[model samples]
Target chain A: MEAKLLLQDHIAKTASITDEQFDYVYSHFKPLFFKKGQTIIISGDKVDCEYFVVSGCLKAFFINDEIKMYILQFAMPTWWTSDYSALYNQTKATINIDCITDAEVLCLSNDDREKLCKEFHQVEHFFRWRTNKGYIASQKRLLSFMNNNVKIRYEELLALYPQLYNLVPKHLIAAYLGVSRETLSRLYASH
Target chain B: MEAKLLLQDHIAKTASITDEQFDYVYSHFKPLFFKKGQTIIISGDKVDCEYFVVSGCLKAFFINDEIKMYILQFAMPTWWTSDYSALYNQTKATINIDCITDAEVLCLSNDDREKLCKEFHQVEHFFRWRTNKGYIASQKRLLSFMNNNVKIRYEELLALYPQLYNLVPKHLIAAYLGVSRETLSRLYASH
Candidate 1:
């Protein structure tokens, strides 16, 4: 299926919009291709775009004083990725996003996305619902961290996104799961 | 100021609505009163209402198997509180919200809020903007938890909500900061 079709499918699940409206929505975000290991965005760079991952993988991380990168998001096919704080604030990003695999992603600049949102209520509605989903997921994640054991968390993660193992690197996945890579490996081997 | 004026102020922050539209928005939520230490919504109960605090404080928490309650939100005046998972799914709540002070809140049901969103695009816009604020705050918090020392985090907490110290119990404030009471008291004394 085409990336535009997939984007439309995702939008349709949340709100109804006509083909003409969808076309307008599609126009706001341009397609950007990247080779594996390419940095799409870096810390202190001005954020001009939010990428919609049509295929392949992108990882966003921040390096702390310990010189370790803490992964914040891993974008796979059908996921959206960006330095959201920078995207919203129009400031330099403290985090960096890199293509971890050769990727084709739909990109939308801040101004164009805002224009699209203002142009059509459908577009705004779609984004509103998307934000809702992200909010609930993140809240549930914090709750999981506070309450669930590692094994239980792993089970819940699997139940929520079955394809995560195949799409993401194990260590990166482990980091996202808030567990050490060794523990993740042991868990995988044991199960 | 009256509750209606506060509603206008809240909506006016993002978008302007006509008097009629404001009235329509206002009709969805009924005014409610809560005493300190009152349990507004318990886990496993049908969460039919989302409260908007006009004054005072409220906290949301989940009780673990060890019976430890982990605080989620410490809502002050002008804040919105809801068990959103249940609000979206119409299921029993997974978290309990309790008033931490005598509070006057406006309660809106999921159905009414949905209808308002569908009928009034302006209302949708307001909520979209509100949700985005929550999203940005959460991202900052997640990063802070990973990188910031407890003292620094405590300082940031106070900087963000200075009134919290006098308005709420130190222990509850500590819980919201994701620290212990002793730690917070020490930080408070040192600072």
Candidate 2:
């Protein structure tokens, strides 16, 4: 499917908009492609745009002082990814986003997003709904981490991205669960 | 300050609205008061409204199957609280919200919020910006949890809620940090 249709379908699920309105909204997005292992965002770099994945996968992650990596999110098709804190607040990115596989995405700049939202009330409604879902997912993830039930967390990880296992490496999955590679192996064995 | 004034001020920071519009928005919010220890929401309850704090504190939390409590958020004055996953999705609450102190709040039903957003473009923009901030904060908390540096988490907690130490009990604070009471005491001693 084309990137424009993908985005339009995603937005239509949340907000009702005419084709002309969607075209106006779509005009603001710039399509970009990335090869596997390509870095889209790096820590300490200015982040101005967020990507809506049209195909393939990308990971938003951070590396601590000890060089331990933690995956914050995986952007599959139709999922949005960015160092949103940096993008929204105009701060330097503290996390990096990179393609896990060769990927295509529609990139929307912060300024353009705000402008579109202002121009179209439905656009604002769509974004509010989008952010609301993101907030709930993040909160749920935080709760899962705090709950410390590895079994439940593993189940949730699978439920969140059933296709992820084939696409992403085990080590990255371990990082995402905040568990050791050994622990992840044990969980996989049990599964 | 009145609940109306508080909400108006908070909305003004993110959006522009005429006094009449503000009044219309304010009308949708029904004022409610709660005594300390009173539960506003519980797991499995149908969640209908989201509260905007006028004064006092509230905690949004979950109790695991082991009966261990984890505090997901502390909603201070000017903050909002609800089982948002339930509120937005029209599902049973998986989390609980309760007052930590005698509190006054303005509650907006999910339907009224949607109605107001549809009626006013600026109202939708305000909510979009509001949810955007919440999404960022939740993501940051998840990153902090994954990083697993207690000292850094403690500092970040303080930065997030300056008056938290004075207001909330130690055990609850420990739960919020996903640490034991002894560990919390040690962190306090170091501070």
Candidate 3:
């Protein structure tokens, strides 16, 4: 499916929008491509756009303690990823986004999103609803991390992403699960 | 401030509302109270509603494999707390929300919240936007846990809540930081 069709499907799931409304929404997002290992946004730089991933994968990572690197997000197809606070707050980015595979994405600049919001009421509401869903999912995952067992969490990951094991690297998945690489390997072996 | 006034201020900050709309929105939430240590929602229990903190505090926690408690959220004044998936998905709750202090809250049944959404366009949009913010912050924190050092995380928490130390217990704060209580104590003392 084309990107617009996916965007429309996402909108229809939440709220109704006319063809004109969809046009206004589409106008703002510029299509872009990135090669693997491309840095979409580097830490300490201003981030004015949020990328909507149409294809391929990306990872958000940052340096810690002068010796270690930590992965924050692994953006899969259909997922939106960015230094969100930096984009919203218009501050220097705190995280770096790197394409893990060659990618096709819709880049929605903060300026264009704001303009669309002002020009179209549905656009504003559409984004609001989108953000809310994200928030709910975020809270759920955080709570699960604190509450659920590793085995349970692993099961959830499988349920949520039936093909995730093959799509992403095991070590990165381990980092996302907040487990040691060895533990993840053992979990994989046990299964 | 009175709970109604607080609710009004919170709503007005995001979107302009008619006085009638305000009253309509307020009426959907019925005031409820809970004493300290009360279990608001238990694991394996049905979750039919969500609570908005009008006064006091609560912690949402669950038991891990080692029979240790891991806190997912510390809901203070003006915050909304619940096992939202159980409430939204009509599933059994995985976490228990317990009062950390004598609490007063505005309770909204899932049915009532849906009705509110159907009746008022703005209310639905407002909540959606709030949800997005929540999602962003949650994912950001999850990433921080994956990437940032405990010191950086603690410092960010301090900046976010300058007086939270005095307001909340250190153990819960440590849990929120994804750190051990002993580590938090050392970090606090060093700072």
- Which wins on DockQ, candidate 1 or candidate 3? 1
**Taking the candidates one at a time, how many backbone clashes does each contain?**
0, 0, 5
The TM-score obtained by model 1 is 0.95
**Per-residue lDDT of candidate 2, residues B35-150 (tens digit):** 99999999999999999999999999999989999999999999888999999999999999999999999999999999999999999999999899899999999988988998
Off by over 4 Å in 2: none
The order by descending TM-score is: 2, 1, 3
Better of 1 and 2 by lDDT: 2
- Say which prediction, candidate 1 or candidate 2, comes out ahead on TM-score: 2
Residue pairs clashing, model 3: A131-B132, A132-B131, A132-B132, A134-B135, A135-B135
TM-score of each model, in listed order: 0.95, 0.98, 0.88
The lDDT of each candidate is 0.82, 0.93, 0.78
| Cα lDDT, model 3, residue B184 | 96
Clashes of 2: 0
Candidate 3 residue-wise lDDT at B131: 64
Tens digit of per-residue lDDT, candidate 1, span B3-56: 779878988999778988898789777998879889999999998888888988
Worst 10 residues of 3 chain A by lDDT: A64-73
Q: Give RMSD to native, each candidate.
A: 1.7, 1.0, 2.7
